[model samples]
Target: MTVAVTGIGVACGLGHGKTAFRKGLYEAPDIFSCLTREGRGPAEGEPPFIGVEMPEPSEVLAPRLARTASFSGRVALSVLQEAWQDGGLDDIDPERIGLVVGGSNLMSREQALAARDYSARLAYVPPRHAHMFLDTDICGLCASTFKIRGFAYSLGAASASGAVALIQAREAIRSGRVDVCIALGALQDLSAYDLHAMRSLGAMGSMRFSEQPGQACRPMDAARDGFIYGEACAALVLCRQDLAAAGKTYGRIAGVGLAVDGARGPEPNSAGQVRAAMTALVEAGLSASDIDYVNGHATGTPAGDDAECETYRTLGLEEARINATKSILGHGLSAAGAIETAAVFIQMKEGLLHPTRNLEKPLDSRFNWVRSEPAVHDIRRALKLSFGFGGMDAALVLEAPDSGGHTS
Candidate 1:
């Protein structure tokens, strides 16, 4: 059972498109300024909420369709279309394609408008609000628009949603289900709703990085504050190596594992993380030492970063060079894992890994953390880790396409 990642589409604080995102990886993070908060914006003089810029849907989609779609709808459509073309999916069987979108588009302005307006006469809810009212809307829209009449659904498990979606797609393809599956993820579109909501919940960063925006997301750094919510939408086209033999493959999704940390709140659990990692190793028919590097789940929060460091030490992978990409790209919530996987593809292709900046003091000296600058390295095998709220942990192992085990 072999799977290949034939195409990638990403839009994050780092950049958009595979080429730009790959180039941005060689430089500092670009958490410039958050411009997605329509109407309700940051107060004057406050440290601006940095965000990734996405092309306006109005320029590509018709005005009527663009206006009525939810923010996730716009992002999912844009990225999926890019991935579809990138993977040469249009030339393949339409019925063989499956659609899976992952996101927790909660507290969005569009949804707020739909559920509000308690007037004296009656509740005036626009018909267009129906789309925002349901998560199925995004999945359904992708299916209808693309004429991809296969299985379609949406789900969220905090930040690991994207990886979970990919894992599910891998299983389906391996189980003799769909021939090709397009898994896409989007989270907290350029809006202040999630920022304020995370602030109220005491989960977002409070450190004033106004003077140095690039250093704001200090993952695995001593001065780490919290994770910044960033807008992102990414899609990956997955198919069996046999089906995509002639196509370009970034890497192969060799193994996958998922677990629950069983934490009811904002707490860290190393057991779940280690379990997921071990399961992935077992599935890949590899061991701890088989991995050349790790793409850590470090999201800059003090507790999360500390817990991940402990997990790495427990798994005996402390010496394996680990890269924390949130230092370069702000957290994309559900889209984090997918976007980070894209980062891994670029790093693998280029034979180097980006360093974690802003680490004046290391959280754990034992862990071989890629610090402060790029490092020349040959990555034949890599593992990506993503842990989210409610103790959800997802892990994936990828091997170079030229690995002896894969024929693609």
Candidate 2:
């Protein structure tokens, strides 16, 4: 059972919707800024929060739902609505459509703020906190707003949550469980505690380029410190290939792979990455040489980037034009995978690859790296890789809509 991506919706620092995102990617790519908003900003004496923050979504929900919906819920509804309408899903039976939201503890910032505000007077705390704290709340909010009756749930795999959700949704469609599915990468609303913890753990970037926020996230660069945080949420509508609307399909989900490293921790394993990539290739009935581009999971972390480079070398994919979407958008945590996947589909359709921002010096000179500036290329097939804490790794093979693949 082949699956086709019929529509995509994105909300990120780059912008909202497809047009704005496309312009931000290829035209004006520099958008990182300091997080200066209340509650989200850094505390006194703390280092500035340097990363991309998404613009407020334009979609306005019903007053009743809006009153209780958290930040993640609002953003998820905005993106999902775009995807649903773009995919022309209204014509399909609501019972045949399912929803899968990615990420866990999505409302950490909301919960933290609520706890702080209500600590002085617990009696005044909003009753909505009971449901808003759970990650599944976003699922319910979106399902109800869109009336998705087939089945809906949330999946959490750290940073790989988005890709994992996408894989699960594909399987649901393949198994004849649903005719269409919406895989959404919910925005991970990190609280100050989460930021402090990551910085303390040495996984988040330091203040080396604090004055120049745009240069803080430099994936695959020798001066890279660690992954920077970004706020983003993206949604993709996938349907059975045969049922995909004509002229609406962006690409085909040819194959998908998910694997876990035996050991636990934040360290990435090249061997596990190799297994995932190889599995995806084999399932796609493709060899290494067939891949024209790779949307690498280069989070700007020193060890993570090196491991991915080695994985590419082992897979004989050095010739594939590769770039790190994180360099431009920063790391969206659980939202990274879906956001980057949307980038791949956009580049494939546009026949152009966006540049890796701030990649002044390449870590590995042997590989083909799109550095500094966007490049014009016709990508027929591409591979997207994502790795998370707890040794989770995921890979997906996407074919252009006109590639004469199963979707065609």
Candidate 3:
């Protein structure tokens, strides 16, 4: 009961839709223009930083929804519309479709603000309906948007949420929970409070790249500074085999493997992540040689980069052409997996894979990290790896659609 992906929709700092995102991947690194508050940015002497910034939700979405939830809902609807147009669902009932969304932070930002205002002596919080913030509940937000009445649930696994959604969607459809399932993955920008808290703890990256907005996120390069934070919402529509027979199948989800590093704190076990990759490869009936490209989860952090490099070495997959997209789109937290998945799908369709940017020196000699140009390959199969905080790891095996014909 393998689930096949028929359509995909993504919104990120790069842009919306396939064309916009891909264009951002090839462009030179530039600083991102951030306007959370008017006239409030870097105080002179900030490092070059570019982010995949989305437009204000009030302009792009309905007025009633929260920013984060609206973005995720829009992505789901876009994918569903594309799936319907991809030549399927003519016979399927719209009521039977389902949704499983992954969200890490949910409405914590809004909730925490309200709680703080209530507790503060000088609390000046405006008279606003705090209940609008209630949909900050992950399940409530997603289910309401997609009208997924058959089945709906939310997953929270840090950056691994997207991969988790893929796994859950595959199983639910296989188990007869529903005929169609659209997996949504999303993350939002840090609330002002979150930023201040992270800065106090010395966890936030300094805005040192103010001179250059685009080149701020440099992964695998020797001059890499730190992770560039980003926000995004992405979704992939999947259906059972019979339903897909009526529609065009973009690709098939052959197998998925999840592993835990068991490493304490921020450090992840590189070896464990690699093991998960190998398991997915095996489960998909593929060999290391069969992998056309590796969509890496390198966040430009010192420890994360080191662990990922070590894993590549341990897996003996040094020959594989690797590309770290975080360098282009910034790290979208929970949405990173889904955004990268969408990027990989586009690369497969376009027959090209973009390289990591701003790399003057190679971090690992064994693996080729393309920085100058997109890698051209007959990508029949792709391996996407995501390793997140708390030692969570996930690997997915995606394959091109089967050719319509008899196999001797």
Candidate 4:
């Protein structure tokens, strides 16, 4: 079953929508800032760390909900609104639509802190309770706002949430469960408690301890210490060609594969990632030679980048033009893979591939890395990959619409 991605929307550290995100991908913007601790931020006296902040939404939601809305909810609403318009979902019946949302922990620090400090007494009033307490309430909120009443699901596969959500959404559409589906991932919590926990886990780059905000993340480079923590949200509308007869399409999702290392650790696993890639290739009915470019799951960490690189090498895709978008936009957690797939569209449409930034000394690899500046290449079929903390690995094959739509 083939699924076509008809529309794409993004709100991340790079900026909002396709234009800004594409510009950041190619030009490599110097976009990083310290986590704000004051209004609308985490707690006070928290350790300061540099991260990428998404720009304010181009169009704000209703003031009634905005006043008390969680950051992740706002981001999700904004991106989904853009995607709805982009996909022309108005043409389809509301009852025929479904949504699959991908996210990590998204809770308001103030609300959680209040509940923890003041007991369950502060749990509910009306809207506040709906946003956090209900597992599917967020999905329902988006459904109600979009008038999509078919079915809704929420999933968390850590950093691979975006990719896993897409895989599931595609299958849902293929199974004839819905005529249209929305697959998205977002993260917007800046709670000091969360940041402190992440940093203490040693998941962040050493540059956070210094003043090198511009040089914080160095994916696939020898000097890479760790990944920079950040937040973002990205969404896509999926449907079959018959449903979107005249709609615009970013690309056709040819195949997708998901796997786990079956081990408990944060280290990236080349074996698991390799299995996912090979499975995607088999499902797409294409060999390694059919892939023109690769968007890896590398997030500047030593073990993660090395494992991803080795995975590609083992899969016989080393010669494919490779890119590490985190080098430009930083890792956006759940939104990482979706936003990176959006970059694949720009690269294929414009025949240009973005390079990894700040790669002063690249690690030893046989793969052809696009470094320093944008490289012109005819990227027809690309592979976008993602890896999560729990050893979850995902890979998706995407091909240009004009690439014959041949899968088998």
Among all windows of ten consecutive residues in candidate 2, which has the lowest summed lDDT? 34-43
Colliding residue pairs in candidate 1: none
When sorted by TM-score, best at the front, the candidate numbers are: 2, 4, 1, 3
Query: CA lDDT of each candidate?
Result: 0.77, 0.90, 0.68, 0.79
**CA lDDT of 85 in candidate 4?**
91
Residue 104, candidate 2: Cα error in Å is 0.5
Clashing residue pairs in candidate 2 are: none
lDDT digits (tens) for residues 349-406 of candidate 2: 9999999988889998999999988999999999999999999999999999889764
Candidate 4, superposed: residue stretches over 4 Å from native: 37-47, 108-127, 133-135, 188-190
Tens-digit lDDT track of model 4 for 1-408: 567888888888878888788878888988877766343344476546777877777545578757655667777888898889989888798888989988656554555555566575554555565455443555866876787877998998888888888898898888889988999886646466656666677777764435768888888888888888666888999997667766377779898899999857577889999899989888888888899899888898888888877887788886799888888888888788777787788788889999789887778656788989899998888889999988899999999878875644
Superposed Cα deviation of residue 103, candidate 4 (Å): 1.4
For each candidate in turn, the TM-score is: 0.92, 0.98, 0.84, 0.92
CA RMSD (A), model 3:
4.1
Candidate 4: count the clashes: 0
Global fold similarity of model 3 (TM-score) = 0.84
Of candidates 3 and 2, the better by lDDT: 2
TM-score, cand. 4: 0.92
